[model samples]
Target chain A: MDYFFIIDFVQSLADGLLFGTTYALIGIGFTLIFGVMRKLNLAYGAAALAGTYVGLGLFLTFNAPPFVVFLASAIGAGLIGLVVYYCCFRFTPEAHPMASLLASVGMLLFLEEMMTHVSHGMPHPYPSVLSGATLELGDIWIRGDLLFVFGICVVAMALLFWLLYRTPLGLATRAVSQQPRAAQLCGIDSARVNALTFVIAGVLGGTAGAMTAAAVGILSPIIATGLTVKGLIVVVIGGLGSIPGAIIGGLLVGAAENIFLLLRGVTERDIYVMLLLFLFLTLRPGGLFGSAATRD
Target chain B: MKLKSLITAGMISASALALSSAAFAADKTVRIVGFGASSGVVGIFGQNSGAAMSAAFEKINAEGGITLADGSKAMIETEYYDDRCNAEEGISVLRRIASTDALVAIGPTCSNVAEPLFGILQAKVDDAGDTGLQFPVFTDVAIKGGLAGISEWVFRNTPSEAKMYDDLFAWIRETYPDAKTIYGGVEEDFAHSRFTWYSVMKTAAEAHGFELVGEAQWLLNDTNFSNQARGMRRAEPDVVAISAHPFTSCGMLREMARQKIQPKVLVGLTSSSSLETLSGCANEAQGIIIPTSFAPVNDEAKAAAEAVAAKGGALDLHSAAAWENAMILRDVINAAGIEGTPDTLEADRRKIRDGLAALTTAHGLLGENKRMPDGEAVKPYVFVHAQGNAWEVVHNPGS
Candidate 1:
C-alpha cells in the first residue's frame, strides 16, 4: 500500500513535468509577442492551431517526411502571423493598445474559423517530430517525447534570449519597445521593428503548435482557447514581459495542476490552478520576474 | 364569333391548369428535415452524411422511387438544418421543424448535445396523454440508448455501444487471457466518454474476468494530461485503454509518453480510428489497437475514402458509415419501387423505414458486413493496430 502511493506520487510528478514542457512552450509564445509590443496577444494560441492544421494539410497532401511537414506548418503559421500584423496591427492607430489587443482577438477568431471551414471540425492526426520511445530509469519512466519537448523549449527560449539581447535587431527592437518616439528620432523605423516582432512571434507560436500536436499526435480548433488561456496564465503568472518567468510559470502551473488532480479529483484541478493565478494577481502581479507589462 | 370564343376558352384553360397545379403542389411535397452539427471539427460526419443521403435520393430518383401497391412513385424531398451541434440550437431547429410539415426527422450528431435535446423531442414523439408534439424522430449519429424515453417513435441507426463492447471484451478474454489489469481514462464532459469509461467498460470488464485497475477523466478542451496520465501509470496495468475522441485522447497519450509510461498493450475507442488520431499521436499511439467498422483496405472502400479526401472530407469509421448507409438506403428505395405523386408520400416513407429495419445484413462497399435490426447496424470492425503513424488492420474480422 505504501509502495502504491509512492508510485502514484512519482508517476503524477513525472506526468506533470511532461506537461510542463508544453505549458512552457505556450507561455513562451505569449511572452515573445508581449515582451516587445506591450500588447497581449489573444491570437497567439490560435496561430499555433492554425499551424498544426497547415502541417497536417501538408502531411496528408505529400505524405512527405515528418520534418518537411513540421517546417511547412511552421512557415504556414508564420504567414498567418504576417496577415495578423498587416490586418490587425499595422493599420491600427499606433498608440491605442486596446485596439491592438482587440484586433488580436478578432484575428484569433478569424483564423480559428478558417481552420474549422477547411477541416470541418475533424481533428488532424499530427506526426510527432521525435520517436515516442521510452527509457525505464528504474522506478522512473522517462518519456522520450517529453524530454525532447522540454529540451526544445529550453533551446528555443535560450536562442530567443540571445536574439533579443545580443543582436543589433534585438537592440533596435528593445529601443523601440521602450521608447517608440525616441527610437524613431534615432532613425529606427518603429513600424519595421513591430512587423519583425509580429513575424518572429508568429514563428514561435507556429513551432509550439506543431510540436505539441506532434507530441500528442492530433490537433483541433477547440485547443485554441485552452492554449490561449494557458499561455495568458503563464504570461501573467510569470510576470508579463519576463521570458524566464513565463517558462517558470508554465512548468509551475503544469506541475501544480497535475499534483492537485492527483490529490483531489479533476473537477477541482482547475480550481487550484486558478487559485494559484489569483495568489499571483493579488500578491505579486509583477510576477517572480521584475520586468512586468503595464499599459501607460 | 366562334374563333373569339375558342381563343378565350384556350386562355382560360391554361390559367386554370396553372392555378390547379400551384394549389396542389404543397400537399404533394413530402418535406423531410435533417439537423446536424455543421460548425465544428466533428461536423465532417454530418456534412458527409448529408452528402450520402443526397446521393441515396438521387439514385432512388434515377431508379424510380418507392413504388406503392398502386404502382405510384413519390420522390423524397429533404431540407437540411445546421444545428451547429449546440443543444440549444438543435432544440430551436427541431422546434422550427416540429411546427412545420416535416414528417420524419433525422440527427443532431453530437451525443452530448443529443441528450437534453432528445428529451425535448421525446415529449413531442411520445406524448400518449395528447400533451406533446407529434413527430417521428430517427436520429442517425446520436448513439445514446436511453433515447426511447417518450415513445418508440425515437429510433437510432447507430450501433449500440453496450453490445459492441460486450462482444469486444468477450473476444479479448478468449484471445488475451494473460492480459490482466486494465488502466485507462476518458473525456469526462462528453457523455460518450463517460458512459464508455464507467458503465460499458466496467460492466464488460467484470463479465470478461478482467479487473479495471483505474479509470480517469480528462475534459474535452484540456491541453495537459499530467494527472490522468499519472493515474494510468500508477495503476501500471498490463493494458491501458483510452476512451476519448481524437484530440484529448492524443493529448493524454503524449502525456503518457512524457511520463514514459508504457504498458504491454494499448487500447482505444472505436471513434479514434480517424485522421485525427493518426496525426495527433502517430508515434505514441503506435501498436495501440482498436476495433472499427471502417477500414480503407479494400479497393472500393479505399477509393471511396480517397474520393472523400479529394473533396476535402476525411473518411473514418463514421464517414464510412455515411457511404455505406447511403448505398443501403438507395437499395431499399430501388427494391421498394414506390410509384409517383404526393398522395403516396406516407406510403413511401413507411416503406423506406420498413425496408431499412428488415435488412439483416447489407453488402458493404468496404470488406466489413453491416448487420442490421430495426434500422441500426453493427459494423464488422477489424482489430486495427497503430503502426508508426497509421491504423493497420492487424486482425481481419473477415475471418
Candidate 2:
C-alpha cells in the first residue's frame, strides 16, 4: 500500500472517532432512558436541540458566556424532558407500548415545528469556547473543539457511571428497570423514578446538543430530525440498554462512516451503515452487552 | 298602507345598488395563488419569496393596479401556501389552486419538489394526448437548470446557473491569472447543489484552463467536514469551489479554516450569495465569491429591497426574482387583456401563460432579462464577494 493511503486511512479514522463523540453523547442519552424505562423516547433529540436553542436564545438575549450557555442547555433540556414525559409517557398505560412511542413521535414533530417557527428556519452562529483551535500531530490534524467534545464526553460518562452505581437513586432506577412491581412493593415510586430517568437522559441530551452546536460552530433546526435518527441507530447498535455498548457502537459507527465515505463516497456510506445495522440485528439481536432478557 | 309600500320600494333600490357594486368589484380583481416550502430547512427562502411577492403586489395595487380587458381598473390578489419543500405537498397545493378561481400560480421552491410537480403539468399546450393539469406555474426559486423545458405550462424567472458559473470562471481566470488548480465540493443530496457542481461548475472551471485537483461531497444536513477539508488541504489547490446552500457551505468553510487549508480563491454556488451565509459564518466565508442575479445597485432595486426588508425578508436573487415575477405577471395580465372574473378564469390563465411564453425580454431588478424559448430567463448578473460580513460587488460584467 502507498504511504499516502496509510496516512489518509489513519486520518479518516481519527476524524470519525473524534466526531463520534457526538454520537456517543447522543447514544448515552438513548441508552440511559431505555435502560431505566425499557421504552424509546423519540423526542429525545428534539428536546435536546430545543435546549440548545434555549441556550442560543440566552446568548442572543443576554450575551451569555459559553459555560452559561451550556449549563442553560442542560437545564432547559431537563425541563423539556419532564414536559415530554408528562405529555407522551405519563398518562399512557405501560401495557400499550405503541401508545408512548406514537405520542413521542408526535412530540418530535411538535418540537421541530415549534423551533422552526421560533427561529424562522435561520441558521445561527454558535459561540465556540475553543474556536478554530487545532493540534497538528505530525501530518494528521485534530480539531480543538472536537477534542473538547471528546473530553466532555469522557467526563460526562465517568460522572454518569458514578451516578448510576454509587447512589440511592441509581439503586431505585435499577430496581425499577429490573422489576417494576418489586420496586413499587419496596416503597420505590416507579412513576417518579421514570420521570427522573427522563430528566437525567434529557440533561445528557442537552449537553450533547451544546457540544454538537459548539463543535459545528453553528446551530440550526435542520439537525434535530437527523440527530434523532442517528441516536436511534447508535442505541440499537450499542445493544439497546447497554451504556458501554452505546459508546462502542457510536465510535464504531463514526469510524466506519468516515472510512466508507473515504472508500466509496457519500452515496453509499449510509447503505453500509444500514447494512451494519442489519448485521447486528440479524446475527446478535441483543447487541454487544445487551442480554436477551433486555430484548422486547 | 301607502307608507309601508314606499319603505319597501326604498329597501329594494338600496339592495339592487349594493349587489351591482359587489359584482363589479368581483369582476375587477385578479387572484393568484403561490405555494412554497415555508417550513423546512430552507424554509427561509420560501418565506422571503412569499414576502417579496406580497410587497411587489402591494406596490402594484398602490400604484393603480393592472388594466383589465375592458379598460377597467383591476387589483391583484395573492395567496401563499406552505408546501414544506415536499413534492407531494407541492402537487397537492397545485391541485387545490387549480380548482380555485386563481388565474395563475407561483413557486414550489425546492428543485426536488418542482421537478415532479412540473411533470404533473400538461407537457404540450392544448395537447389531446397528454392528460396533465392545464395550469400556469411561474417559478421564482427552483434554480436547477432546464426545468422550464419540462412543460409548456410552466415558466421560470430564475437565472441560468450554467451561464452564471461560466461567466464567473471566465472572470476568475482573467482576474487571477495564477489560479490554475481548482478543488470542488458539493452537497450531494440536493438536486440543485449536485447539478450545479457536477454539470456547471466543473465544466466551467475546466473550460477556463483550470485543472481539477480534487472533489468532495456531503449531505445538505451534514455538519462535519473534517475529512473533506483534509483532502482539500492535500490537494493544495489554488481555487476552492463549493456548490452548496448556505448551511452546508458555511459548515465546510468553517472546517476549511480549522484545517488551515487556505485556497487563494473561493467560488460558491449561486444560491449561497445571500444574507444567510453572512449570518452563519461571516468570518469563515470571507473572500468567497459568488455570482448573483440581484443587488441593490439602483434606486428601484433599493426600494424593492427596503420593501422586502419591511416585510421581514431579505432581497436575495431568489426573492428578487419573485418580486420581478409579480411585476411581470401584472404586465402579462395587462398585455393579454385578461378578464379578471371567475367565469373566464381558465381562459385568463391560458392567456397569462401565452403572454409569459411570448415575451422576449422582461424588466429585472438589475437589468433586462431575456426570456428564452424554453421558458427560462437569462438574467443579468454581477459577481460579489463576502467581505466583513457583507457581500460587496467585485465586478459588474454589464458595466
Among the candidates, what TM-score does chain A have in each?
A: 0.92, 0.97
Candidate 2 docking quality: incorrect, acceptable, medium or high = medium
Model 1 clash count equals: 26
Local accuracy by lDDT, each model: 0.71, 0.90
Q: Write the per-residue lDDT of candidate 1 for residues B1-399, one digit (tens) a residue.
A: 999999999999999998886564423334555778767767766786666555545555566554434544445577668887788888888889877656567776777677777666434323466554445556666665555443434555565577766777777777787888888688887777777777876687677878888888778887667557766776788778788888788788777876678887777887787766776667768888777667787788777766666655656666565556555655665686544345555565556555655667776755435544444555566778888767788776457
Flag clash pairs in model 2: none
Q: Return the top candidate by lDDT.
A: 2
A100-120: candidate 1 lDDT, tens digit per residue: 889988988888888888877
Residue B368 miss distance in model 1 (angstroms): 15
Prediction 1 global C-alpha lDDT: 0.71
